[model samples]
Target: MAEINMRQAISDALWEEMERDEKVFIMGEEVGVWGGTYAVTKGFYDHFGAKRVKDTPIAEAAIVGAGIGAALVGLRPVAELMTINFAFVAMDHIVNEAPKLHTMFGGQMKVPLVIRTAGGGGRQLGATHSQTPDAIFAHFPGLKVVSPGTPADAKGLLKAAIRDDDPVLYIEHAAMYQVKGEVPTGDFTVPIGVSKVQREGSDVTIVSYCRGLQLSMLAAEQLAVEGISAEVVDLRSLRPLDMGPVIESFKKTNRAVVVEEGWPSYGVGAEVSTRLYEEAFDYADAPIKRVGQKEVPLPYNRELEQSALPQVADVIAAVKEVL
Candidate 1:
């Protein structure tokens, strides 16, 4: 067993993958010299050298385009986009090229690429830089989306994403980088398209991912004090969403509170709520409640930013209401 933070776990995943597979290389802006925008690739420059850790210009499209091209040629390229808010600049390559290469070419080629970026609004990076548009990426077909909450999932999911033969959008929460958790040291990889039940309860089920899962866990602890047992189901993979565990949890709890950091409308929670109604409507005792961001441009002020996101209190109240 190894105790590590999400950042370290990701670094470890990158290091191990590159060591295991020579085809696996990293390319992005400031990835090598600056050690990545979040220091996730801190020592990669020295260990992997400039060849394996090829830093490129500031153009996100070029970074993504180059990654796709490399993947088509049998290289497993892990491209970094600094922050996911910048993904829009590279959507041409992400949505058009990477996802289409495999099928567009009649299955003759494989685009085994992974684009990694971070999201979340707690840091007050403002509207331009602070956005959690996970559902936006997951909305597209042929792209695997992964947003892990704990260190174990972070390491496991990243490994799986790199190994997968399709393009993956790996969104990490900015706030979770320093959050520490126990992770396996030896060979381990959590399969993509699965959900993990973080806590067992019967009153209400809290379905969330990334930082939202942390908030749900916090709310669960408080709910326990009030005799309301709220189960926490962490949706580790967003696109290939493991709806099975969510259905099972809702069936047992009879109530659900869908939580996410993205906008409420057309969000992951909305999809989950709809599915719960479709597959497990009879099991639900009350209408599902959802908690998400305030749907406005993220504010730069710390107080406004904090108020804009779903908080522990919001989850608690929602759980109480659904229960």
Candidate 2:
């Protein structure tokens, strides 16, 4: 095992995968020469060379469209859209095209492509840049969506996405790049659409993913001090969501609080809370509570931005409400 930050873990995954497979290449704005906007691919250009590390125009459509073309022709391309907010420009390609290619072509073709993008509030990116619309992409069929909260899951799942035959939207939290955690060394993958019980407790269940997972863990520790046991479940993959762990945890706890950085309405929290009620209604002791960003455009002001986003206190309060 190795202790590393999300940026290092993600960088390791890309570097290792590219080294292992010649077909794997990265393309996006500032990816090659700029070492990626977030520096996840800091030294990839020098190591992989210009041929493999492509730096394309600012157009998101061209990036994703070109990626689909590359994938169809027997290449695995990790297409990076500077931000998830920019993905809308390439919506047709991502949701309408790449994902449906294999099925639309009667299984004769495969779009083995991964769209890498980051979303979340904080750092004062403002409303336009800080939207968390992960649920929108997850709603479309034939597309795999994954958001990892820990360094280990980020590394493992990214490798898995790069190697998958289907199109995948790999969502990362912009604010979590510096967060550190334990990651196993080399050559392992966490299967997609699987949920993991990150922390076990008997009193209540706190379900989340991405940045919310980090907040929930912190809230769990605080809850423990007050004699409240809160089990934390990380929904690593969203589209083919594996509710196994969440259901089991809810069965044991009989109460749940779903937390997410996205808005609550029709968001991850809404979908999760709905499924919990439908699948495990008999076991539920209280109405499942949801903790999410306030329904408003994220403000540019630092204090206002933090206020709109879900916090540890919000999660803790939701957990107590459900209990």
Candidate 3:
């Protein structure tokens, strides 16, 4: 195992997949020459060359549209939209077109395209630039969505996304780029539609992904001192969501809390809560709780921003409430 940050892990995955498959290539604004806006593909421009590592125009729609077209023709394209906020300009192509290709064409085609986009607040990027729109795309039927919470999961799931036969929206938290975790030295892939239980506890189950998962795990650690055993379930994949582990956890814990950086209403937490209600309602001993950002645009003030977002205190408080 090797300790790597999310940025390095993602870079390794892209490089490994591109090298392993001739059909795989990366395209986006500043991806080639600028080494990507976040520097995830820092050396890709030199190593992969201009043809494979393309630097396209500033148009997000054109980028995703071209990616969908390329995928239909047999190539595996990794298109980066810089930040997911920019994905709004290309939602027509992403939500309406790319995800519909395989089914609309009667299985005669597939969009083996991977859209790598960054999300989450905390960079002081403000309301417009800092938004978590993952649930929006996950609502669509034909797309796969995965937001890995650790370095290993990020590396593994990204490889899986690049090799998948369906369109995948791979969301990375802008704040998680520097977060580090152990990754296997050899090639490995974390399967999609699978959720992992981060810590085993008997009191309550907390379901979350991305930055939200990280915070939950932290809360669980602290909750241990108070004799409140909290189990943390990481929702690594969303659309092809794996609720088996969550259901099993809920059955064992008999209490639940759904956490997310996105707004609570109709967010990832809503979906998890609904699934638990439908599949494991009898197992839950208490009403399912949810923690997320306040239902307003994220503020620019540091103090207000921290309060608006779900914190470790919020998770602990919610757990106490349910108990």
Best candidate per TM-score, number? 2
- TM-score preference between candidates 2 and 3, better one: 2
Kindly list the per-residue Cα lDDT of model 1 for residues 139-217, writing each as its tens digit: 8788899999999999999999999999999999988889999999886798999998999998889999998999999
Measured over all alpha carbons after superposition, the RMSD of each candidate to the real structure, in angstroms, is: 0.8, 0.6, 0.8
The candidate that wins on lDDT is 2
Per-residue lDDT for 9-106 in model 2, tens only?
A: 99999999999999999999999999999999999999999999999999999999999999999999999999999999999999999989899879
lDDT rank order? 2, 3, 1
Question: Candidate 3: worst 10 consecutive residues by lDDT?
Answer: 121-130
TM-score of every candidate relative to the true structure: 0.98, 0.99, 0.99
Q: On a 0 to 100 scale, what is the lDDT of residue 290 in model 2?
A: 90
Q: 214-319 in candidate 3: lDDT tens per residue?
A: 9999999999998999999999999899999999999998899999999999999899999999998899788999999998898898888887888999989998
What local lDDT score does residue 302 receive in model 1, on the 0 to 100 scale? 96
Worst 10 residues of 2 by lDDT: 119-128
The C-alpha local distance difference test score for the whole of candidate 2 amounts to 0.96
